[model samples]
Target: METSERIAQRLRQFGELEATTSPLYRRLAPLAAARPELVALLRERRSGQPPANVLLAALQRRLMARPEAPLRGYFATLGGTRAPDDELATAFDAFWPGELDALAGLVRTRRVATNEVRRAAVLRLAYVAVARRLVERERPPTAHLVEIGASAGLLLAWDRFAYRYGSAGFGDPDAPVTLTTTWRGTVPPDPHAPFTVAERLGVDVEPVDLDDPEAAAWLRALIWPEHVERAAAFDAAGAVVRRLGVTVRAADALTFLPGGLDALPGGLPAVVVHAFTVNQFSDAMRRAFDQALGEAARTRPIYRVGLEWAPGGARLELTTYPGGRTTLLARADPHGAWVEPLEDEPATTSR
Candidate 1:
């Protein structure tokens, strides 16, 4: 794709994402449409790479709750419930050439990474859906959980978050954070179904450390300013991670998964979970990872639960070891805000 097209592509993508997920970002969409210079700066800033997600990578970084940024106070006010649409529009309209120029400079020099929001916390909703199916199928005595692309290992701690979907509820009733989403179709899964997690391990190419203030700040910045609830959830999840002493190793998924699966003790049920992660891998790498999973399945059962984008919707899929049969379990919102279970479960399938 040409540089201009790539720039326009990212802008449109983020704009669309904001249209659904964030009112503040939706309000600011005109700025992107009106200013071609923003696209040029992002395109030219990173010469040979996919266009930088300047909104998350650069602008949010400066506005993040960091002591050094003078704009932190501004961010705090806007992040609050009192934040009005007019004020938000004014903020963007006023930022213009000055703030935008600085943001462009940051994109050029600061090495801003894409959002690894590690939003697996909410994905627990999907996990619960799969877990109930697992209980019905095999009822594994215990599950050894492994997560790929588990930045900060937050999702590995899904068991810690409370969830309420319609009348169903799961996890700790007294959990600090609660995720509630309405059911879309089919009866909701039994949230009270029993499952055990024996161990949790996670791998990421560059894992964030919740304990490190700077690293934690970056994770917070990944949340769009308009999504105040998500920002609060990140903080709540981080605190839980620290309190629980969760740790994720810095390793690429391609190299980590095979070994991670190989080391799992035999006889115990093993499950690998990845939410919006494997899609980042190249076609060859994805095939190689699948091949490795197949090899491991020959030795022991490994249930793979994945939430990924499809042409129709975000799909929740399950794959069992040995034959590596997969099932389309549900279609969910990317953030797990809603899950619509398949009315008639498909036969064992593979993608």
Candidate 2:
């Protein structure tokens, strides 16, 4: 178990980092950290889960359940018009104690599996780049997209949504869900490039069943109270996913990758993708996953696109197998708000 002082430090750091993006969390996190009660609640979080996010989600879930609760008025997602203020901390303190048991249950069970559909913006750009390269090398532009830790498979439907990157538009113009992202640095691949998703498959340890209201509600609760747009996009994407009937198989990444890659239809390459997923892996598991991919590549080509956090910040990386070349595509927002492409040459590594 983590010490209260350590947990408090994490909360303070989280507040500082989110100061610009989520004003509500920024103000409340530091205040929550000072209260030993709130710190104790966060201490119960499962391993690999972010304590701050877990605490916030638990509080949000309680507010979601009680529509008429006074605390709901403070959350933008819950139709709250009030902005974050000093009184917000007082409101949170009063709200948490009454719902202590429920909040504790939530923090203990839930993982921060926020399936941000906006990430499709980053994935779409990488897919087009990969497709263009494949076409250049005389390979087919079609691919089977397999996502690791794909919650609800919303991102698997990347091609189903329209995107506006700065002035450039991509995907179906008539699509239900449209995502707009800020583009920075060198030009990305042609938005008009041809790339087909032959099929979509997702692997996760415990796949979320959107059909379950409780399960879907947990996902909604995970969204920051300030991000009303994100909540709306999630709902829209869920509708599209349900209509398309996307499937996510419940399995571990290390156990699933080898067979999953081999099972893909022959003649076409596999575009393996993951976003904010590998950070959950233990060091041994990460190494094993890399070995699995390397072993799979010996049989056929595999293109892996990863949007993950490193020491400095989140990166958009494209790693190709057979000759294990890794390209630093861009630095990106964890939630896909923006992308800053790298101008340097691609980096190579021997697998």
Candidate 3:
């Protein structure tokens, strides 16, 4: 297909999928519309042959807009849904012609392209929904969670923010859900009643090494397109992650996780553990990690928590052992952002 047609189609898909009937989506629609030249600019630069960086940089410019010039010494990281198009991959191989890092630089020009990456966002939303489920289901007199994807982990420290739960005041009473966390169910557990994220330990394939300026720039780039608050949150979280230098087992998740399962620290009271939204990896990797957790949990009782995707809705599942059956902790708003527990069933059913 012509590059323009392909780019146009991809843009349309983003418009539909990114909108949530919530403020974020409504705002993104016009933001996208305002950039029509994006399609033509990217398409005109398309090539049927070699010199990879040359071709990609042109198309990439359509999607990216650097905040400043003089990139004389900065580095670029190329992250995206692993689902690279086969044809595009072939072209990339031929074009950049072996200058990998240089090409990553060319590709990292801040394109609207990655915004089309819905799968990861879906996984992220799933994790958030499930965390709420676990909280409500395991409503200890009070509770706190430690998360691993704390990109800003600020979201991990969510209870710290203000929010509304039915009529009662859950958030700080000072802050409200300016982002609109709507839901349709028995309302979720209200906040500030005594919840905290004592800590957040995040792992990334190429973790931003918060101390490194270049890494910090890549982290900033990953912040969602226009959500200034989220962007700020990422910056705050990035600082914490950098300072805390989390027990970040440093390797791609596949290599880092199995040992991480075995290395779980002993002795903690009232701890519910989880991952926010890193489930966008291959099925093989997910299974390997799940198996490792199961094996490790045989003696230890860390709940293997997942706020991951299913077909129609998101779900929260907890597994303490492989033999231990996993339960659907709750069904969440596909887009609304939190999981309220369906606790008609007793919590001890699994415990």
TM, every model: 0.80, 0.89, 0.54
Among these predictions, the greatest TM-score belongs to: 2
Better of 1 and 2 by lDDT: 2
Q: Best by lDDT, which number?
A: 2
lDDT of 2 by residue, 1-351 (tens): 789899999999999985567888888888878988888888888987888888988889889888877778889988899987668867877788889899889988898888999998877768877888789889879888899999899999888899988887877889999999998856754655747888789998889989988889899999998899899999999999899889899999988978778887777788889899998789998878877888888767788888988766588888887667788877878888887777535564444
lDDT of 3 by residue, 1-351 (tens): 455556555545555664342233233333333444444443443243212222233333323343232221121222222222334334332333333344345443422211111122222333343345446657432322444443433334344344433443443455322234444456544332343334345444533355656445544554343344554445544454445455433456556554554444444222234443445657776677667656655644444556555666666665545354566656554432544555433243443
Shift of residue 3 alpha carbon in model 1, Å: 5.5
Tens digits of per-residue lDDT, candidate 1, 1-351, equal: 356656766667666764565554554554565567777677646544434344444666655534444333345423444343446545654554666766776666533333323345335544555566566777654678888877777777777877777887777889987767667766656544435678778878888787878667656665666666666667777788789887688888877766677776767767788878888778999888888887777766777888887766687777777677777777776766667777435445755
lDDT of each: 0.65, 0.84, 0.41
Weakest 10 consecutive residues of candidate 2 by summed lDDT: 342-351
Please report the TM-score between candidate 2 and the true structure: 0.89
Model 3 quality (TM-score): 0.54
Order the numbered candidates by lDDT, best leading: 2, 1, 3
Q: Candidate 3's C-alpha lDDT? A: 0.41
